[model samples]
Target: MARLLSELISFLEALPEPRIVMDADYRIVAANAAYMREFGAAGGLVGRRCYEVSHHFSVPCDQAGESCPLKQSLESGTPQRVLHLHHTPRGEEHVAVDTTPIRNEAGEITYFVETMSVVRHSSSRPAAQGLVGRAPAFIRMLEKVMRVAHSGAAVLLLGETGTGKELVAHAIHEASSREKGPFVPVDCAGMTETLFESELFGYEKGAFTGAAHRKLGLVEAAAGGTLFLDEIGELPLSQQVKLLRLLETGTYRRVGGLDCLSADFRLVCATHQDLRAMVAEGRFRRDLYFRINSFPIHTPALHERKEDIPLLASSLLERVDRRPGRRLSPAALNWLQGRRFDGNIRELRNLIERASLLADGDTVDLVHVQEMAEDLPLDLSASAGDAAGEFRVSGVQPLAELELAYLRWARRQQPDDTGELARALGVSPRTLYRKLRAAGA
Candidate 1:
């Protein structure tokens, strides 16, 4: 048994990724050079608990509300994979963990071999580019992205309008085997049949009127890489058949050319619309839906992961605010966290951009953000005198709930303009929007 364990450790040492062998009790027995260099302890790692070394946790990861791959592998008797935020030497980082159970000759599970890899395309902390999230929903979605990144499977991203599907698609492309190849994005929204053909399949000179030169289509440009089709639900049904034929045959022809050009690119489609329902309603082709739905990943909406609001807002402020040393005040962050964003990340980014523009000093305060929210278009037709009545509520309720209810009632009286309603209610427009969203109005 000792010799077998030694051999297993030696074999893991040759691998590039960080690998560790631990007992069933989660004590680190052996670690490869990669593991030592990446997650080295002040004292040697051996004899230390894996959870303590990696997560600084007194208990197992599962006890800490994280999925424990070791516990999972023990139950399934197979490999288990999970994404975890690990405490690294630099800082907290998003790490993908794969654990396999090692059984002895008696068929009893003896040890576990765990491999760790850091996610480069994303960050647990705020990042300047790529994905920035630490919420459970974000991790769940990222786990799916990592699983399908190395494969040739067609990817379908489904989410709300501003859920950052295109960014997810780009992350997939960057992580995939075709990282060196071009990543071409084609917006399917409002794309005409003629444009779809010429744009996706390229066009020969004189293929149509005003054809001055031959053009390379998006599919051909993305050779050996990924082609992202954004908002594919908006694509006209008339053009869907042509796209289906091209995908099925793996070939296409120029507008005026006769020779069929072979397409050599991975397909990734995204939509805020439900393609299954579209198929049921005869609005989308079932065959094409199946083709692109090989590996579907859900991009979580901002509201679903509200815990990441501060991180997202900080990162977005960095991206949008050109003024160096500018930052959001704590009050501003608090206000942002309490507000609602129906347009998700995009809406949050716009708010930050507008606030940045309005802010003159280094720090953008709550008033700056509130002013931006107040600038929202309102009906402004109803007068404030319409809301001059006593507000009443029955039954026991939380103070916050009561406040939100009162805001809703006040909103109904002055339904025309939220800015005017805020003045009448003696609250800021930012407060009005937050309470309104909480009230589900």
Candidate 2:
């Protein structure tokens, strides 16, 4: 039944911007060249279910309470147009679709002809458009990030992990004068002191037992660019001293070499840890901390601006499922706002991804969200019990310390479940084991 319109599909080529013909069951009978190119559906189009191809949905559009222009035109025997947000290869876009019905001699609708065109709105949300929020806190943070990006000052991004510190770091690098240069990022959380030095400062051939060839360190690799050191708070004091010398002297020598080499990279370091507490406890060097803390910026946690939940969830959902019309129903947005995401955006992303798997429909509703919430890690209920005391509360703990403590507890809980532990921690199992080894677990 779908391929019945295959003969007329080729005629839509001139309409442009992804035109398609669909049958009564929402199956794509034929698609134009624009549709194929834009949607990456060049080879196969005939007989494929339209909802699956366009929305990643298991059902029809009207079922989601969305105005299905196709259905409307079919029933009324007239033109139908509806504006909807579409996920394109470029990004999330507002598209105006014009749907026309093809009818038989008896005036019964036989097929739907859809023409899509991208729309530009005057009252569009700018800061919230791609970044996905108009909340004051998020807006202020974006302003600070933009300001910090233009300067050459060392940036100390203070945010809980998964609050998007690295994203801001990349934004800063992109906005800087050194954007054309390399933007190298290194995870400092899981390296030994020796490994840290070698990785950051490179190594001469025969520098160590396994040193078969000369290699450039991350610093050298990032010369004339930005070197982003992630999880800076976890860097050991021994390695911190070396990093301090490089920052102070602007030079570092290769492992097993005397000649000092210069690296002209801008420094951008991030940590969720409170460095002042570490400095007071003599765990972090005051001099190094002062040097790197030149321009401090904080990324707000998800719970900080709950008002932006709708924007963020919609943006994240579109990102997870890029099919043009996939989305979360209003109930799903409310569901997200009502919950406690101690893990912040990272947790929300995981939940959304999981819910997408569980949801058989185009829209993820309250039921789908609640069903997926059962598996979320770090139960607040458990946190209220003795496990709360187990997680601890001192005057103030470094972020790294808190994370390590949680990892230990989670490890105990899932000793044989590496995947579960990784999912719980928002990291891969390889990263989980690497962190354990680095922390001497």
Candidate that scores best on TM-score: 1
Cα lDDT, model 1, residue 54 = 83
Error of 2 at 22 (Å): 53
Q: RMSD of each candidate?
A: 6.5, 18.4
Q: Write the per-residue lDDT of candidate 2 for residues 232-320, one digit (tens) a residue.
A: 89999999999999999999999988888987999999999999999999989999999999999888987677777777777777767
With a 3 Å backbone cut-off (N, CA, C), the pairs that clash in candidate 2 are: none
Ten-residue region with minimum lDDT total, candidate 1? 375-384
The reply for model 2, stretches above 4 Å from the true place, is 1-130, 322-324, 375-441
Each candidate: how many clashes? Answer: 0, 0
Query: What's each prediction's TM-score?
Result: 0.87, 0.57
Model 1, span 111-177: residue lDDT tens: 9999999989898776778899999999999999999999999999999999889999999999999
lDDT score at residue 333, model 2, on the 0-100 scale: 85
What is candidate 1's TM-score against the reference? 0.87
In lDDT terms, how accurate is model 1? 0.87
